[model samples]
Target: MVSITFLGTGGGRFATIYQTRSTGGMLIEDRGRIHLDPGPGALTNMARLNMDPGFTDAVLISHCHPDHYSDAEVLIEGMTRGGINTRGLLAGSVSTIDGIDGIRPAISDYHRQLPSRVLSMRAGDEADIAGMRTRFTPTRHTDASGVGAVFETSAGTVSYMGDTAPREEVTASHEGCRVLILNVTRPFGARLRCHLCSEDVPAIVERLRPELTVLTHMGVKMVEQGPEEQALRLERMTGSRIVAARDMMRLDIGDSLRVNAPTLL
Candidate 1:
């Protein structure tokens, strides 16, 4: 079964440091373990949680922002076993691969030349990774990781809305998604500049009516109301499963998916 785990749950400048809180991205393990968005706290957070960064069979960088692709070089080294080989696939924006202001060359030439493949994609392009199809859905956010990802799994389609505000085009692509991971960086009614806030989710929820809507990539300010509570309110408001994304949390894909964390089982 294909399973996904969030390595870091918070996003933006402030990373959770109190104990085990994380930021920005996650680890997806299907036939292989793929690391998505190695943000500021990704490596260290994975280490703390005993999830090895070296085991990532593939790496998907959503963009070139520091909070997203900052650790790409480090994680790439680990994934290739200190540059021994690049057995994993690397997928992201062209800037993240070819060359962007200072973000280019995140992966070494030797590793890039390895068995792995790198595809630079814009909006509406579909790429295949480990039997699952991924489409780069355009977002308003500008960064090295230009577009968000839509994962088409064996069970169903899941949309990873990377740092997008309320956009009809973005939500349009999310229609019929079984799982939707929205980057609700702020609490309800608190309007964020570009990131999504809690209150803004109902529209997407009501429109898409996804079977499961997971809220993640929170900012420090969102910590005040607590993500779990926000998730509960969101569930009541949207009539959908509002999951509070947390580090090491896993979900299995099947006829019906089940959410389980490392500590839970």
Candidate 2:
């Protein structure tokens, strides 16, 4: 079985700064523990939930944005057991691995050396990690090198949209995925460039028609407007099972997907 835990669901500058919701990102447990986008509060959130970072077998950063890679180095340290031993994989986009103009590389050279192997990924790149085949999907964002991901796991295929605008390529890339997670950062009618809004969900859901759709990475506007209501609206429009992600929410995926109610930790 493949299990996923949402450590944080909030996004945007204000939301991340004030921490209206946690920004620690998600954890995927399959052949091994995989940490995705360990942003601010990642370590704290993991500790609060009694999740040991030492067990992580890989770290993935989707972009060079602070909200996506701020705590990555620290998580790498944990994965490598304080850098005492070189271990695990670190995979991400070109900007994340080598940085773009005016943007510092997310993972430092020292942290990059700690990983057993570091892969500089681009759209359409595929790599095997922890027995699963992962494919990088393109993203249209401020970080031009940003990419989304699709993981073919033992249980099923899981797709993450990362921080991107809704594009036809994304729909094509994520087709046939069992679970689809999107970073919807704004509410309907409030479309923003380089970021997804609630208005974009229905089309993507309709195009992909995944078994389940999870709405996460909510900004302050989306949060105040109510993610649940937005989800319900999208479900009605697309006829797909939709749910809003919350901190500490757990999902177990096998023949079917099961979501556990959020619990305070």
Q: Could you tally the backbone clashes for each prediction?
A: 7, 0
Instruction: TM-score each candidate.
Output: 0.89, 0.98
Query: In model 1, where do residues sit more than 4 Å from their true spots?
Result: 16-20, 100-115, 262-265
Q: Tell how far residue 248 is off in model 1, in angstroms.
A: 1.8
What alpha-carbon RMSD in Å does predicted model 2 have with respect to the real structure?
Answer: 0.9
71: Cα error in model 2, Å: 0.8
Please name the candidate that would achieve the greatest TM-score relative to the true structure: 2
Worst 10 residues of 2 by lDDT: 256-265
Residue 25 local lDDT, model 2: 90
Candidate 1 weakest ten by summed lDDT: 15-24
lDDT of 2 by residue, 1-265 (tens): 8999998999889899999888999999999988999889889988988889999999999999888889999999999999998889999889999888888788889999999999999999999976689999999999999999999999889999899988898778898989999999999988888999988888888888889999999899889999999999888888899999988899999887899987665
Cα displacement (angstroms), candidate 2, residue 179, comes to 0.4
Query: In candidate 2, which residue ranges exceed 4 Å CA deviation?
Result: none
Summarize candidate 1's per-residue lDDT along 181-258 as a digit string, tens digits: 888889977777878899888899999988888888888878777999999998998788888877668778778889
